[model samples]
Target: MSEDPASSRQSSRNQDKTWINRLMSGFSSEPKSREDLINIIKEAAANQLLDDEAVSMIEGAIDVHERQVREVMVPRSQMVVIGIEETPEQLLPTVIESAHSRFPVIGESADDIKGILLAKDLLPLILNGTEDFTLEKVIRPASIIPESKRLNVLLREFRENRYHMALVIDEYGAIAGLVTIEDVLEKIVGDIEDETDEEDEDGFIRKVSDNEYVIKALLPIDQFNDEFGAKFDDNEFDTIAGILIRAFGHLPSRNEHVEIDGFEFRVLYADSRQIHLIRLTIPES
Candidate 1:
């Protein structure tokens, strides 16, 4: 018996989709090595079969396998932690301020992490106004991973164990940083902006207020100038961070401000090394 041509074509299309999903999942029976899979993906991208975002995500997935936990985990200093002895009153404000779903419950300091505390777990207690709040009651054992752990392996463990956040430890068995499911996913799918992220129409510069715009320091200087209708020289620097560093003559700390070309560039958030977020205010002319 001969098969229907239409049915055969539909089956072929389904097989292709399955193949693409397997590639996306980073488990293809045909492509044994990373290079082989990447080459196939690049060929597909070059042929315009896969869109740019899809190609980029596929490339990111390959890169994730090559990366380690330490490379992607949020630095220890930047981690928001809840004190083990804190009352419900104190904890409520802290949770609201950070807007974080999960926080590490710490004993003496950030290094002395007790366990993971889910914000949702405290919702019922808060609603009932439970004065005698016990940290041990709500805290759950945290999953710990070595900084040297491979992303692919860690991701698999995360799925198997249903772990959302993991405490990354160093060679000394000290809390080095934190890695979340979101962080791991972002490594593949790129930055996942939250509801709090106030991005503008362009999606580069975010609106902070009537006159203030929170801009990503990585925005290209040319795009920055074009976005705000300002004249900023891109000859010496490529990105907004580059220009700011040039102007400051050193790495600017948080709250540092520089007025250039009628724009007030204030460092909304920064570290000793790089500016993460900047608030740019353009006075109404």
Candidate 2:
């Protein structure tokens, strides 16, 4: 006789609940704070009741509640935007070069954001005819949000509204930056590499330009030195992130940069615990 799948699933769920209850039973009282709860979870992981990835995800979920949109948004200066007055020929190169799915369409300046232009929306114009193409016709209404909005709330809104991108504004209603669904999700589950991310075969580093590169914080200091022709001490710190953290004296936030030995190291992606990725800009010799 074949085993019942439903019964097997129920047994598995019951076993999971039993272990979870056992883990909680060790606590004399309910967790008094988030930190205490996290400590309990860490203990469970240490005891083999929970895995490392599960602990990380739970911590990330808690961290999201404490973070605001401003913490993870791509700054206005780095935003790749399309001018409303730009022609198809002019904007195509930007769309292709940036490799971004959505771009904010600006009217006069970066402050005067009109709407969002999706790269896929241009397919029909390219195939049919460009003569009838106008950015005003294909642009979608942009979602506006404040920089102070919390990540958890933003994630809920993103799911409920079915939109991916939002323009973040400051107290004065000026565009501060932009945040995406991926950015918020990354806070919970860590980095989500898409097809657009062009990295080396080892996935440790990606050259952005002649003098700039995006690198994983886990890249060994020895390999980094060999790649960049710079001598950084690896005896004290194994990875570039260790050297950076020593220089920073604390866990740095996204977009924060520090110059060490003529090399500009900027935090690209990081959370409460540690830095994940960085942008390295080599100085001209």
Candidate 3:
């Protein structure tokens, strides 16, 4: 005899309810702290109740609540800005080389930010000709935000206002850095690859100059050794980040540097959880 589909569906719903009830029962009391909540979620994953991705995302969401804009912002020194007085011909190379959709347009100084310029807004000028191009006519209002703003609050504003970028200002109202919607989302989820990201081995380690390189902390120790020709012991730690964390004896914050075997590893981006990016400087032989 064939089983009834309706009966099967009802049975499946009952099973799901039972599983949920069992999971809820395990949390006998409310989680006292974020760490406790994370521990419970991790235990649930260990027991096959929740998946690894779900646990990671939950932890990330909690992390966002504690982080500030300054922690994840692109530092002012690393920001690529377009001078307000620059002609279309002069800015085209910067626009093409940086491959960024939006740029902060500056006036007399870097602190004197005028407005934000969209790359697409310049297409008409390129098509028609730069003979009549005026930056003020094309630039849009800049979204200014404070460096101390929490990431959760910033993310909400980004969604509600439909703005992708914001200029971060310090206590003195100077341009400290810039933050984007992608930067906030990356905290919740993992890295989101865009068109500009290279898909080759060089993608993990990008050369900034003859002595400096930008590297992803997730890059394997073996791959790092292959690139730099260093003899790092990969047996103890799988990734270079692990080795660095061990060397630091604690989680390192952004801009923190440590020297090992004459190589300088400077933290480019990191949170309470782990390091994301690092800048490597090779000592001259």
Best by TM-score: 3
Instruction: Estimate TM-scores for all models.
Output: 0.64, 0.77, 0.81
**lDDT (CA) for every model shown?**
0.82, 0.91, 0.89
Residue 241 in candidate 1 has what lDDT?
Answer: 92
lDDT of 3 by residue, 18-68 (tens): 767766865777778887888778877776678988888888899999999
TM-score of 1: 0.64
Better of 1 and 2 by lDDT: 2
Instruction: Rank the candidate models, highest lDDT first.
Output: 2, 3, 1
Local distance difference test, candidate 1: 0.82
lDDT of 1 at 191: 74
CA deviation > 4 Å runs, candidate 3: 1-19, 25-28, 203-214, 219-231, 234-238, 249-257, 262-264, 279-285
